[model samples]
Every structure is written in structure tokens, then in C-alpha cells.
Target: MSGLPTVDDVRAARERLAPYVRRTPTYAHDAIAFKLELLQVTGSFKVRGAFNAVLQLPPEQHARGVVAVSAGNHGLAVAHVGKTLGIRATVAMPESAPARTVERMRADGAEVMLLPTVAEAFALAEERRAQGQTLIHPYDDPRVMAGQGTIGFELLEDVPDLETLVISVGGGGLIAGIATVVKALRPRVRIYGVETAGADTMRQALDAGEPVTLPAITSIATTLGAPYVSPATFDAAQRLLEDVFVVSDAQAIEGMLAAQEALSVLPEPAAACGYAAVLAGLVPRPHRGTLAILLCGGNVSIDDLVRWRSTLTV
Candidate 1:
């Protein structure tokens, strides 16, 4: 196949990843159905890509180990994959990453490095990659995207008449993979990507007609703070998604609180922003079929929740 993951590649990924990932269930509430990826292993859909990226490596490379850079969830996913598969893993994360997530990676037996910024973490991971360690990129790889595409397969099977899908976009892997499958199988399904206001990587990329880097990330949704989108992901979003919506951090917090009240599930700001778009009337309600929003992660800590509640008047 080409650099982009094909539908057939996604099908193979589903079979290959069957043993490592969860087929998260969808929950219907009022006008929307939520794809509860927050309940996925590692508290996010990132594990699907992590496992697929690592498991595909030739056995000989396991000895050379692997390196990855992430804000939090992807690091946790890579660490967990390393432990489960008996491969050595090292993760570089920004110092601003959640403390609980850092501890989890260490507890999972991966060497964890704390850098001053996300860009430094990426640089560190690149240095390691140049030294022969394989880089299991968070979103750029076709294998990782194929793993995420598995969610599209499940979504279609569960909601056969699904008319619309709203997904939170970070580095663009999640929406790209899902849109590939959803559009391939159900041509008319409208897919939209969402981002918190300060971390609108894909939206900026869309405007530039190519992937563009942000000056800095300022959203409370730290996990959504990718510096830029990959070309493949940008192309996929440009070709497949109906549009990309940007929601404020305050609005995302409101959506988080709403989901907690309605579904009794607490989601991180990154996960809640897509639903925030739905709540803020950015996404149109589907007339005849299901409108699904992906709750992509639930990695927020109690301390963070308390802080958000005290500061943000939601």
C-alpha cells in the first residue's frame, strides 16, 4: 500500500490487534451516541496504535528497544505495550505531563525521561531514534493509523445506519484512520474533526493546505497539543472530513461536566471537545440516523478536575 493506510490494511490490523485492544462499546444518550474509547486500555484509544506499532516490529529490533514522545496517554500506552510484550521501551515526556501518568509508565517498567517541553521531548526521542532505537511515533506511522482505523470497523458494525461521526483531533491520526474506514465502507457518513481553541493543529493545517506547526500549545487539553499534523493525516482530513470545529477550553470543560452528568463518565478535555462542539451547536444534528461522538480518553486526575472546577466557571 501507499504511505496512507488502506481499508485492507485496516482489516489486517483489526485481526492483528484483536488480542491487545478492547472493542469499546457505544452508548446512546439523547440525540448522540458516544463511542466510549475512554474505557479503552491505557484510558484512551492510543493503546490500539501503540500495540500495533510495537507488535509490527521485526523481533530482532526488540533488542534495540524503542523510543516515543507523548504528553501522557500515548506514553502510558507505549509503556504498557513494552511490559506486555517484553520489549524494552523508553518514553520522553514534557515536564508538564500528568504526574500520575509518569508514575504509571515507570510502574509499567519503561524508562521515563522528563524534558522541559514537548519539543525537547520530541528531540530527545529523535536522538534516541538516530542512535538505533526505533521510534514508535504517536501518530505519523501508517501502522499506528491502521490500528486506529479498527475503531471505524467496530463503529460501522455497531451503528450500521450511522450518518455522522465527530472525533477529537490532535496529531490527526485518530480521525484520519476512522474517516478512511467509515468513508470507504459507508460513503455518506459525515466525519468531522474537533480541536480545543489553543491546539488547533489540524484546522491550521487545513487552512494552509498542508500540515502547519503551532507556535505553542495553550489548551488545557494537553494531550491534544500536537505541534503539527502529518501530511497523510492532513490529506485524509482534507479529503474525508466534512469540517473541523474549534471549541474553547471552557466549552470543553462544560462538555466534560455534561458528559459526567448525562453518561456518568468523566472525560479529559481532549476527549470532551468533540462533544463540546455538539453541545455548542457547531455540529449539525443528523436528521435520520445516528450522530456519534468519540469520547477518546479519560486520563484527568482528581486534582486537575478540582482545579478546573475552581477556575473555570462551567
Candidate 2:
């Protein structure tokens, strides 16, 4: 409960969240199996953690309400969960967060406050917590990580012969949860994490042998732009993750476009980072079996997509 979530913890979370979230589907193309988590209820896998964390709160705590800080997807998830459970929710997001993301959170009935930066959003959330609101951290909480681990549970069940799992790392919650479960269940399955070059918090943490905050992060994949990795997530990644790689923003955009064209799904840059690593040959090709690439989110606006697509060179 304190450190990395166990397989049992993930299993329990899966059962706890069975009614609220979707199982999501997996499909194979070429040698890579795509876990289409973008199809998830809130347009991202964060809903798994959001629902799990919110539901675990006592009724009185729920009445007290919840507060969270997110670049985008986590905010939307928390907002959606709060609306579903009839809890008051407030989300602090950066001013630079995509307009569509802000609109979605507002549409879900959360009081959205736009701060100067993601760091400021976290500070605001902490302040709100001091005022008695239940704080739902984006990635640092064990319960949230346990909820995210449910994705690994589904992956293993859907593809029993899965040889490798490529996941995009933000604050490391998603990969940490998944790696803990996958390593425990299938020790031979290699767990790899991907990050955009400028926002590689996990890679930086692994290199430093501890978590460190960056002065700034700049990536088109705003969802992957955590300033630092949490101690719990760092420990889990160090012990359980096989390797971590980084992809350029250009590569991520290319992967996004490719996924849209081939898979008929528009993946946000963070979601496409892992697939970008594969496409760029940063990850070795699996010779004997299949690899699974987690297409984690799809929350881009058409205008943003058009702008990104226009950047592609001939």
C-alpha cells in the first residue's frame, strides 16, 4: 500500500472499478498489439485511477469534495468521476493546457482554475487540501497507481503471450503500476517506458538514482510534462522497469499521424510516445513474439491536430 501496488492490489482495484470504467480493447497490427486505452470512458486511462481513488473515499469525505491538479487528462477524469459520484470537484490546470481540455473539464461540472503553470496548479491543489478538500494526486498516490495497474491486468489477460510492453511515462504512475503487475505476473515480459525528449522525468530520475525536479519542461505532449517523479514511482520504476527511452517531439507527432492513418485513432502526443519509440527503432524489434504498445490517450482538438500536422515535412 505504501510502495508499489501489488498484483493483488491491482486486481482488487479492477473489481472495485468494474462498474464505472471500461475494459477497453486491444488490437494487433504487424507485430505490435495496441491497447486502445484512448477509447476509455474519459478519453484516457486516467479514469481508472480517478474512479478508484474517488470511490475509496468515505461518504463524508466525498461530501467534503475533492481537488486535483493535472495538465489535462487527469483533470478531465477527476471531473468526470466527481460528476458521476455527485461529489463537488475543483481542478487546477495550467493556463497553457489545451483549450479543449479546459472545456471538457468544465463541461463535466468541475470548477476549473487556470494557473500560471503546472507547478502552480499543484500548489493551488495543496492549498485547497489544507481547506479540507480530499486531495487526489495525479500520480503519486498508491491507490491511484493501483487503479492504473488494472491496465496491466487487462493486457495480460487479453494477450497471454505478450513478450514486451511499451508504455509512455509521465510522472511514472501508469508505467509503475503496469510494471509492478506485469513483472509479478509474467517475469519474462520486458517492460519499457517512453518519454518525449524534453519531458523525460522518469529517465532523468533513473539517471540521478532519485527523483529530481526540472526547472522547466517543454514538450508538445503536455500530458507527459511532469516536473518530477514521485519517490514511490521512482522506486517502482527502478526495481521493476526494464528500460526507459526517449523520443523527439517530431517523432511523437509522426507516430500520432501514423496511428491516426493506420489504426483510425488520433492519439495525443503523450499517448503516441511509446509507439513513436517503436517506429523510430529506439526499441528493439521482438523477434519471437509480439510487443504491446499502449496508446494511452486521445484528447486532441481538431485545430491542434491541424497545426501539428502542418508541421510535418514532405
Candidate 3:
């Protein structure tokens, strides 16, 4: 795999995953546009990467099974893909992950191990790799980033006049892939990344000129709570991304509520970061054309939604 996924890589991934993943739609609300990746198969864009990575593996490797580490969405996506491809999957998730997310992964037939933290989950996943399981990293792998890049390909096709693309960053696979494709296809179109203030991995990585691990991730947007950005993702962001912005947890909740009110969708806090940036005016708007905000995932449970709703009134 290359250090960065090329446009050809994304195109190939699109062809390979055409039948399995949805070409999720984009819609304009007010002056801003939204890419509804929350409507994807596993209720998140993570499935695109999951399917791409799993399908790329040799058929013989399938027998050894696959392992992954996730706060929630990535594990759920991997579990869903493993079931569809008939491979056994074991996911190491943080013990603090939402119960609904844990239950969803279990329902999809993955053996879910609850680790004490995200770092520990990754450590356990590495150990499982040493034990012969194929490790499908959530965001660090090129194949996975190529898969996520397919969304950028779709965006250009669906919204040819797009002037800027705003995306939420976690471990950076999603934005890395999208930025690579978008920049290649339309260099003039700016790409921006958003993260919760407490979990600003990409911002810190860019500021330091290298990937840095945070001592702790304290954001309510647990899905965007990657402790460190991977080298590939960090490199991609530096080369392609125009700017990175941080929003408070409360602003993210407000963005979630705003999306639900305007588009009738309740995005998880991580997915809401892009919208949060817009709503908070943390990033500059396009002067001449439409800005596309990626609504990356919508995996929050009804109970969680109610709790988030209460925060809005407070």
C-alpha cells in the first residue's frame, strides 16, 4: 500500500464496493449542503473502509478471522462486514463506549471484548494480530482510507459545483481519503477538518509537524476521540487539508440538534463536528459557492438522543 491513497486507488475501491455500500445522497439546507453518510449500511461511513479492507484480504486469510479496535462505529462496521463476508470478527472496544454501540456489535455476531480504554483496545488488537488474526485497523490502513475516499469521488459527481468540503476528523482516515480525492479532482476546492476541542488530534498533529498522542481524550464525541493521528493520515492532512478547527462539546450537541431540526437527522457527536463548526462559525464560509458538511455517522441510541436533547435546553 502507498503512504497515501491515490485517485486510482479510490476509483478501484469504488468499483469493488459499488454493490456493497450505498452511494449516500447529499442535500442542501439553508446555504450549506450535507452529505448523509449517516444513512450508510452500518449507520456510518466506517463500513466503506471495513468492506474495502476485508474484501482486499486473500480468501485464505479469511479463515484466520479479523480483529479491530473501535470506540463504536468502526467495530460495528467491521462486525457487519465480517458477517456479510462470512469471517469471524473480534472487536476490542473501550469499556466506556456506549452500551447501545456495544450491543449493536454483539448483535452483528462479533466477539466484543471490553477494554479499559481506547489505547488498551488497540494494544489488545495488536496482540491478537500476533496471534494470527488479521488486524483491520479502523483508520490507519491505506486500503481503508482508499475506501473512505470513495465518498469524495461521489461528492464531485453529485455536487459538481462544491466550493469547500468540511469533514470531522478522528484517526484521520475519513478526511485523509476524502481530501486526497477532492484535492486531486478539484484543487481549488478547499478541504477543512473539524474536531471537538478536547479530542483535537489532527490539529495538534498539524501544529507539531508530526503525529502526537494526547494524554487523554475528554470529548463527549467519543467516536472522534482518537488518541493519536496515524502517519499516513497526518501526512495527507498536511498536504491536502486547508485548515482544522475545534468546537466545544456543547456546540457539537447543538449541531446535532440543528441537524435533527433541519434535516430530520440526529448525528452522533463525532459526525456532528462538521455541522458544529458551521453552526458555531468556527470556519469561514465559501464566498462564492456552496460548502459541503459531511454528516459522517448517526449511531446514537434513542436514550442518548434524549440525553443530548436535554443538553440543548440547558
Which candidate's lDDT is highest? Answer: 1
lDDT of 3 at 8: 94
Q: What are the models' TM-scores? A: 0.97, 0.96, 0.96
lDDT of 2 by residue, 139-224 (tens): 98888999999999899998889898899999999998998899998998888999998899999989999999977887888889
Q: Model 3 clash tally?
A: 0
**Which residue pairs does candidate 3 place in steric collision?**
none
Q: Higher TM-score: candidate 1 or 3?
A: 1
Task: State the C-alpha lDDT per candidate.
Answer: 0.91, 0.89, 0.90
* For model 2, the run of ten residues with the poorest summed lDDT: 305-314
Which pairs, if any, clash in model 1?
none
> What is the TM-score ranking, best to worst?
1, 2, 3
Ranking by lDDT: 1, 3, 2
Q: After superposition, how far is residue 205 of candidate 1 from its true place, in Å?
A: 1.5
Clashes of each: 0, 0, 0
* Candidate 2: regions farther than 4 A off: 311-314
Model 3 TM-score, 2 decimals: 0.96
Alpha-carbon deviation at 174 in model 1, angstroms:
0.5
- In model 1, the runs with Cα more than 4 Å from the true position are none
